[model samples]
Each structure stands twice: as C-alpha cells, then as structure tokens.
Target: MLAGKRILLIIGGGIAAFKTPELIRALRGAGAAVTPVLTRAGAEFVTPLTISSLAGEVAHGDLFDLTHEAEIGHIQLSRAADLVVVVPATADLMAKMAQGLANDLASTLLLATDKRVLIAPAMNVRMWEHAATQRNIATLKSDGVLFAGPTDGDMACGEFGPGRMVEPLEIKSAIEAALSDGPLKGRHILVTSGPTHEPIDPVRYIANRSSGAQGTALAEALRDLGARVSFITGPASVPPPAGVTVTRVETAREMQAAVQAALPADAAIFAAAVADWRVENAASKKMKKDGSGALPTLAFAENPDILAQVSQMTSGRPALVVGFAAETHDVQRHATEKRARKGCDWIVANDVSPETGIMGGSENAVTVIDDKGAEQWDRMSKADTARRLAARIAAALGAS
Candidate 1:
C-alpha cells in the first residue's frame, strides 16, 4: 500500500524508540523509502548506525553539520518525504511541535516540512494525561497532525493507563492511512461510541449493555477510507481503535460537551447508548445500607438530548448526521419517528431485545431508516455492518 512512498521517520527519545528498526523494516518491506532522523536523546535508546543500517540511508542527526547545512539539507529533507512519522513522540517533542520550536535537527525539520505528520506518542501515564500535554495535543490536532496511539497498557514505567506507544504494525497501518487517497480523504467525521455512565453515587451509576463493538468497528472502517475521525467515546468495554483522535467521556453531559468541541465535522455518527436520566442529587460519598429494610430514595433528571441538539442545529451542522436506535420492540416505527423528530439525515436502528443478543454481541441486524424509508439488513458481524454503513456514508456525503 505504501509503494514508492517516502517516509521521513523521526525517532524520538523514549524507550519505545527501540522499536523503530523493526518499523523501518516493515516500511521498507512495503516498498517505501525511509529517511531517518535520530534525535540526540533517541540515540540513547538506539544508535544512529543501527537506524542507518536498517533504513539504508544516512541517519541525519546534526542540524549544524557543515556539509549538510551548506546545502540547506534540512529544507531538502523536510520537503522530500511523502509523509513524516514520529515514533514515540515524547511529550517534550510534542510540546515543541505544538509551539513551533526549532532548536534542534528534528524540530527544525518538522517545522520546515510541508508534508502531513503522523505521531505515535509514548510517555508516562501522568504526563500523557497532564493538562499541558492535552492542550498541546488539541493544538496539534487543530493544526492537522495525524496521531496513531498512546493506547492503554503496561508502561515501561511500571505504571499503566494510556501511555504506551502502539505496536509497530499499528503504526504502519496508520502510515498507510495517512498516505491513502480514498474517497473520504480530507473529510472529518465525528463518531460517538460506548455506554455513558451516569453517576448515582460515588460508587454507583447507570449504564447500558453496549459493548461499543459496532462503534469501534465503524470508526476503523471510516479511518481506513481515509477520513480524519474524531472519536468521542464513553467508558467502553472495547478500546478505541488506533489512527483516530480519541476523546474519552463518562456521562451524557460530558459526551455532549465533547461532541460540541469536535464540531465542524463533515459527518457525525451518534452510536453511544447514553443514559436518558441521571441522579439529580447523587451523593458525594458512597451510599450506605444503614442496615434498614428501606432503600434510599433517588431523584432523576433527564440527560441532554445530544442527537436532537446536533440534528436541530441551525448552523455548522454536519452534512450527514446518523443516530442509532436500540429498541426492544417496534424498532422500525420508533426509529422512523426518531429520524424525523431528531432531524438527522439517517437512523441506524437495531433490536436489542435480550433474546436478540445484539446489545453486547458480535453480530447485528439493523434497519437503515431515512426519508426514503427503512432498509433492513441481514445479521452480520459488527465489522461487516460497519463497512456497509461506512460505504453508505461515503456515498451520501459524496453525492451531497
């Protein structure tokens, strides 16, 4: 898929940099040329000689090299690649990129580059979640930078939770996607997935049976079609896919806020099973049994109608807005009503009756409802369903 491509690979200073030699081989095996830039710190984990040997190109390291500088090699290197990829994009490096800092060879080349850049972040969990790092991430996304992963896993720091660099193969896939010229190229799609948790107390909340399989699959399908995907997900049983920007939220209110922040998208898909109501006066601490037969009374408030709000928007609305309806009965009628009531372009409805096993299952039977009416689809794997839906979305947006 990457034949004849030129990749400017920047290996950053992180333990994950040790994986770049393998990545270089993978890229080369796919018929791409790799020009490596080894950061001073990156050299601590892997030698420039090793990188140069694997990539079959001189691993550029010094911005002040007399011979290279005389010819403005940095400018030449920056503009020569089809795509620039940073493996183990350290927090410091990301901050530098976000701020347009060019104090070194890597940062300088990044600033000089006219190519799309894809970064795979690796850092301590706290650093990944730090407010400053998150701000930098938001800035980078706004600047049209692509991201692979800082997925949740056991970290080299002996800690866990969302700071591990994605595996080399995943990075390769991301590279392919970054360079793809598919139908959805240059389009930004917003996808909401999983089950929102509405807090009832410090330890208790309301949620659904949604496993987020279909949503995750759909996001990946759209990503493979070259769409820049903004994935706003709730607490899900399945992890969010790589190669997409992920915004994690817990409640319907939080999801609404995240969706709003990810706006100006070309299309939006609302697939989350958000709670309809939340405890109005949730306790600050865990509620106690008190050894009494009576149960604690709870007041409920309706959650925000995110689909309706976005669908009814008078301005900045997505060209296509698709919402999901998980029903127990009368699926078609209720979903049809929902499509008109929400003002969305389409409704993908499915029966989640316990007997159907579709709520948290691997397969789905759905009816795609629109102004043209319902089109029932046979049960299939969530991945297949996603591909069909994504194709439909591509066609819809393409025609519009």
Candidate 2:
C-alpha cells in the first residue's frame, strides 16, 4: 500500500537505535524508499555505514557539507519525503524539535519539513516522565506531529515502566494508517479504557482486572480506519495507541471529567471497567495500622455514571454510543437490559467470570447487542474483535 512513497528516517540517540536496521527493512518491505539521517549522538549507538547499508542509500548528515548541500540540501531533504519519522526519538532531540531549535541536520529537517512528521520516543522512564519532556510532547502534538510507541515495558535502564519504543511492525502499521484513505476519515471518536482506581488512602485503592488491551486495540483499529480518536484512559496496563490523542486519569471522577472535555465526537465507546463506588472518606494520608485491635469503618459513595450521562445527552450526543457489559451470568440478557438502561446504541457483552480468564487475557468472545438484537461473534483475538467493531462502526456511520 505504501508503494512509491518516500520516508525520511531520522535516527536519534538511544539504546533503541540498534533497531533502526530492522525498521529500515520493514519500511522497505512495505515498498517505501527510506532516506536515513543520523545525528551526531545517534552515531554513537549505530554507525552511519551500517544505516546506509541497511537502507541501501547514503545516510545524510553534516549540516555544512558543501557538496552534499549542493546535491540535496536540508530543505529539499525535508520536502522530498511523504513522511519524516524519528526512531528512538531521544529526549534531547525531542526537546530541540519542540523548541524549533535546528542546530543540526536532523533538527533542521524536522523544523523545515512541511510533510507530516512521526516520532517513536525512546528514553529512560524518568526522562520520558519529566515535566519538561511532557510539555514538549504536548506542544509537539498540538503542532500536529504524529507519534508512535514509547509503549509500556522494561527500558534499557533496567526500570520497568512506559519508555520502550514500539516494534518496527507497529510503526509500519502507523505509517500505513497515516497515509491510507480509510472509511472513517474526518470523523472523531471517543474511547474510554482501563480500570479506575478509587483511592482509599495515599497508597491503597480499589481496582479491577481490566488490562486495557482490548480498549487500546480498539482505539488503534479506529485510527486505522481513519477516525480521529480521543482516548480517555485510566491507569491502564497497556499503552494508548500511537496516533490518537490520549487523556490519562486515575479515578472514575477524573475519567468522567476527561470524557466530558472530549465532546461532540462522532462516536463514543465506553470500554472502561469503571468503579461503581468510591470511598466517602478516603484518607488524605496512609491510614495507620495502630495495634489497638480496631478495624476502621469504610464508607462508600456512588461514582458518576459516564455511559448513561453521555448516552442520554440532550445535545451533542455522539451518533453512536457503545457500552461494554462484562457479566458473570446471563450475558446476553443482562447486556440487552444494559443497552436499554444506559440508552446506548450497542453493548458489547462478554463473560468475565474468573474461570473464563477474559478480564486480563488476550482473547475475547463477545456478543454485540443492539436494537436489532444480539449478534453472536466467534471467539477471537482482541485485536480481531476490535477490527470487526471498527468496520461495523464505519458501515453504520456511512449508512447514517
């Protein structure tokens, strides 16, 4: 699908830079012509000769090389490609790009590029979570730069958190989505995912078995279909999709607020397993375990019903509002009732009984219930289910 497309691949400094050769192979396998540009720091991790060998083209660098500048200057290099991608986008490189400081060839091409730019960030978890880096990322997103990965996993620094760069295959998929003429183009969708943590104390909280994989997969599917997605996620185990706008929260109330802020979408999917109650008198600090043989009384308060509120909106309701009913018994019957009660257009019903291992497992078997009735689906991978749902959504929206 990417036949004849030109990709400018910018290699940044990080441990993940070693994967650039594989990334080049993936892009080339997808019929894209890749032009590599290595940074001074990037050369420390991977040699320019190796990059050139993998890409089958001369890797470009040196901001003041008169001969190379005369042949294909930074401006031409920036404009020549359909997309500019940064693999292992280091914290320093991202900072420079965000600030529009083009002191080097890579940063200069980034600053000068009119074409769409995509970055796969790779850094230490602490560096990735730094306030300055977060601000720069937000700025870059606002400026319409695309991003992929920096997904959750163990990093090179031996700390396990969300700083690992996504695999090359994942980046290739994002590239295709960014360039494809899919069915849901120009549409906006809202997706909620993960289990909310209703804190009882500073460190203690109530949560569920939601891994957020299905929701993340669904968001990716929608993005692949060309929809602009607002991903409102709680404390999810899985990272959010590459191309969507993500709003992360911890509590049910915060998720509700984030959902409210992401308004007027074409569709809304409530895949989050939200908590039904929260501690009425949640402790500000950690509750002490005094050896007085006294058990503290805990009070509960009802949490906001996000699905019902959005479904019953008098104005600006999404064209389709889909809720998930994870039932332990009477799946179809309960899901049908839930669809009516919540006033949503559809309910994706699944059996989440402990024995089924559906809550955190990779596979899922769901029955989609709508006004027309329940449509039974075969057991499939969560990714497959999401793709089917996205296709259905496209058809429904098109018919409407």
Per-residue CA lDDT of candidate 1, range 1-400, in tens?
A: 7999999999999999999999999999999999999999999999989999999999999999989999999999999999999998999999999999999999999999999999999999999999999999989989999999878899887999988999999999889988888899999999999999998898999898999999999999999898999998999999888888888899999999999988989999999999999999999999888887789999999999999999999999999999999999999999999999999999999999999999999999999999998999999999999999999999999999
Candidate 2 stretches greater than 4 Å from native:
64-72, 153-160, 185-188, 228-232, 235-248, 257-265, 284-293, 309-318, 328-343, 351-357, 361-381
lDDT of 2 at 352: 96
Residues 103-171, model 2: lDDT tens digits: 999999999999888888998889989999989987887676777866778877789877789888888
- Candidate number with greatest lDDT: 1
How many clashes does each candidate structure show, in the order listed?
A: 1, 0
Best by TM-score: 1
lDDT of 2 at 31: 87
